[model samples]
Target: MSQEIRGHPQALIDAEKGTLDPLPGSLSHSKDVKPPPSDVLLSSKEKDALVTTTTQEVILSAKPTASSVPKSKRVVSRWTLWNLWFNTYRKFFTFTFGLNMIGLVLAASGHFPYGVKYSGTIVVANFNFAILMRNEVFGRFLYLFVNTCFAKWPPLWFRLGCTSVLQHLGGIHSGCALSGVIWLLFKVVNNFRKLNVTHDAVLVMGVITNLTVMISALSAFPWVRNTHHNVFERHHRFVGWLGLICTWVFVILGDTYDPVTRSWNLSGVDLIHHQDFWFTMGMTIFIALPWFFVREVPIDIELPSPKVAIIRFKRGMQQGLLGRISRSSIMEYHAFGIVSEGRHAKYHYMIAGVQGDFTRGLVQNPPKTIWTRELKFAGVSNTSTLYKRGIRICTGTGIGAALSTCLQSPDWYLIWIGSEQEKTFGPTISRLIHDNIEPERLTLWDSKARGGRPDTMKLLKEAYHYWDAEVVFITSNYIGNSEIMQGCKEAGIPCFGTLWDF
Candidate 1:
């Protein structure tokens, strides 16, 4: 007699005698099994059981097939062309405004003398200067400016443009060129005892050269504004030496000649031209005295290998009206070589002298304990569990400090947060990422990308969930530090931050 199977079709067979696995042909036969005509079909509950079983089997079979499929290709999002145009417009507006201020100052000072006829001329000139400031938009405006100003002399423009480009190449090149010219002039005057170069002439030349150097150095301010402070300082030092050379050339040439006699006589300036000679002699001696008196003394200090030693006075107590006779001297030291390798390390020392009686000399100090604490925290090892690892979130300048800490510990995961057009942390981020840091390990939370700071918090929570972050390190300069820390506390996570003591 034939019998109908109930529940799961596979369950109807005897466990000891029957095989759970289906034969190849039997598997195809199950798919062929169908309900009878509607009037004679099984009850609703029985139909429901059969449908559920078939669905489960289909899903289980599809799982293996889906697992073998490759991941979808990722598409990079590109900024719209209009966004680039808007940035160009904003930069143009800023440049034009600055030039307008300069034009107004010149016109008020009678340099431009603005009238109805000159009104259009003034606007045109201001606009041209603004265009010249932007490299991408400068070529046409620069050509027009040169053509108009020099009476359409193409050669003059060529020379001026080339000189301008070279001058902007770097401060070191400009400084060296200026100093070399002045030094050559000084040597020529000293060697030629027959021709007399007047002291006033030398002084005027020195002043003009110094002023030119100063203006050139100041012109770089706009470009250097976006650069690192260390780069600016290096440029300043180069320009400063040029100024000192100009001063030296004037003093040497002026003191060696006799103005009254109209001849070069290097008899100590006292025998031939007494008064004028003594004046020049005194000035030159005064300028050279500091070189002799000021000396760099080395001090033992425990810190980084390339640390700078700064000796600052305790305010009030110097020669000049600026109340800062402070004399500074830098002593640079070079290490022998690197351990196991041949590389060498270098160190610099800067010492300043306060011209006062009965004062004690201070030595270089050690690094603060807080610095050590931060470094230690940054060196924490990575872990599989989020609770055991630390998360670093930063904004503004704190990004650099945080990134430096992050790079030292590669095993740990990092969550970096930033704001729109806020590049204060860009240097740190770029450095870490360029070193091959994992993308999955980093979650960049941008405020602008998420609407605002409130939205940033929501996204931060989502990132935390994605990364299973335990410790949160915030590096923002904004005043909402307390709010962020509170949120982390509420989520049962500990937070560390810069700009806030907590």
Candidate 2:
């Protein structure tokens, strides 16, 4: 047999060293004999077989001996930690909050003239921006604009930066929301101090609005969101709606009533002329936009295993979108990554792993109809068009997020690491991968069959160089995401991982 094989060169080298054991269905190798190119197709005869075809995959059944173990010592320096700390998210937050702080200092020093009169305008302006940042319609438009204008035309660093910026727009949203609340507090206090011009009704509404906004913001704290999700959702959403109502009252009262005359002006023109009124209107429209798309849609649920539920929706979606579903229009809303072949396909799917109450309910009592918005939101993967070629690395359910990009675009490579992939995810997901993904562009590491997880960093580095990929997108749990991100940072490889803060 010739030493040169069509498969991954590293696999051939490992075989030559007698350090790797092939899985039962995989092609076996010996010192003097090399496997043929066609032999890379793993047999489908095995029980619960993981069907894969390709040369670049590593499917091992036995654990490597101590002497054969690959050394994957990660060295992260303080510089790398600092770079990670000052990420795109923090930068957006800092820039926005810093500008607000400067304005606040000016107002506190009494340098900003008419600070009391124009304070409402400032508050509403901040809120308008904050709401816009979170608006699904605006978000989709931004992603579409970026992908259309700069996809594969810009330099690698520039493209990576664009994706980072898109992913972290929530930072701007957070900073503006907190700043708006602070400005509202200042406005309310100043109105109370200026007793002559401020009407009592306006002051009361301001106070109530301030409290509602504060409560809504507090409910969104990470601890509250992670530990008591239902509480967070209710308080954040319902209280936010109450805040908006109070804000409308405050704006109308403040704009229409003349504090100097201690009387109300019922004229509609004066209310329409106020800057704060228009700003509030813009934000209200943004806040209510998604709700306009709300509908009760029929769904088909396939329960492959107790661990996961595959949900199929009517129309196919483009790659890199996420959909939020709920049992009712006002309750238990959860966001999941979407998997669709393309817009032309008959349907798009969401992989609902049994992670929480809503998802668990899907497996326990599947619903025939569910509440969802017609317009799905965009995610970082939506920026996949920016790169010429890239790698999508995900673990377990993360595959739900990572699979569509690879399926839709042949230039993208996929590396899915999981245990009992076919059995846990079922035929729907299995068929999608098998039918769309070519063997040369895939690496399915079944940790259950392999005895343990492979060195993922080593696998990623190998793929990054061999595939000549410009960027890497990772979707994994906290620890796995952290480890892979750290490795990528140290290697100076441009990459993006799942964002937990949002």
Candidate 3:
């Protein structure tokens, strides 16, 4: 069930390793001393000392000081506002919902006779699209198509737009899901209006299905999903399953029963010909697709510190793919970024930085086998190939999401800012960073060693120019993501950061 990923150009490992080529006007800083051999494991104290020294070297080598970097006046252009709106998750949600609302208004006003058949069509179609947007297989195909077709050849704006496509697709999923519920409500209400015509079973199914769908939708609201994730997870999933079952029953009963003739047609061909029946089939397939790839796989968990568990899985994956794992096959699945040296590597990894119940459990008692989707989904970083060169910046466990891009692509530079680089993430991550990434194209800033957070904006601005990067990708907590994204916007630098919408 696992999807394979192709490796990037192996020239990255060529022994010559090539010379540092800084962009014009970039600081001519001395290249970092090559990292020690992979076989040599450094102690935590030694690694911290090395990182401290390296940070100092980078600062000293750079010509521009924090104060010397020009501060741009905070100016938001009309075009900038439009571009931001165009790329946001909310925009996709609004677009999907807004389009549906127009039809809903017409249907509700009685201007259009959108009876049970028409409303049922809208409901199933919306649900179908909603499920597809979040489908792992479909999502991977989309990333592959975009990266393959547009990588490095498309204009910067076009490529940047492509990156936003996957990240905010949840908006479409959410919008369509809610729209489906609304349309179902309309269909059910219409059924009640003609109780004489509706069958007793059909009426009962309509009411129950509406309630189930509404419950599922309400459970998925931001407040419920964020504050009570377990509640949201269980209700949204279990209730959704119940809703799907009801929908199938409703489709069958509605399609087979003829109110006008007071007759029933149970023929398979007749059921196949019904539009709602086919739509329900598509909805069922889309919802059930990911589960088909589900399997229990053996895993090796490495607890570097109490805060993080580095998990190793069999086989390799491309950068920007995420896999969902759970202790049980039915519930409590959590997603973490997959880090690998690409297809040629023996295995891929997931950095389970103890964030929630499932991750904390990994550190408390690691499992021998964990339930997971064999086919992983793609994220925005998968578009790394679109840019000739870019920077992957992150903080703390955010490195889990950012590391694979730099590891997989020599065209990418890495800047991992964390409290304890080695102690927190353990040796597995540290080794991956040191062994795979060349020192000249890398920067590791340890806040614990440096005493406090570094001036991130200054560092990013410096790296953006010094590395000659076409774009900057960030994976950090909300505050850090906001600060860096805002700074980049003001500086007119193209950048993407971790999305908080989901």
| Model 2's TM-score against the true structure | 0.87
Candidate 3 residue pairs in backbone clash: none
Which residue pairs in candidate 1 collide? none
- TM per candidate comes to 0.25, 0.87, 0.85
Question: Which ten residues in a row are the worst by lDDT in model 1?
Answer: 1-10
Where model 3 places Cα greater than 4 Å from the true spot, the runs are 1-86, 114-117
lDDT of 3: 0.72
lDDT of 2 by residue, 169-277 (tens): 8778778888888989999988888877777888889899999888887777666666777877788778888888899899999888887688889999888999999
lDDT of 2 at 175: 81
Candidate 2 ranges with C-alpha deviation above 4 Å? 1-75
Rank by lDDT (best first): 2, 3, 1
Query: Taking the tens digit of each residue's C-alpha lDDT, what string does model 1 give over 266-323?
Result: 5653543533333334333433432343333333332211111222222111000011
RMSD in order of candidates: 29.1, 10.5, 9.5
Which numbered prediction scores highest in TM-score against the true structure?
A: 2
List model 3 lDDT by residue over 108-202, tens digit each.
Answer: 88777764347888888888888777777788888988888998987899988888766677778778888888888888888999989888899
List the lowest-lDDT window of 10 residues for candidate 2: 1-10
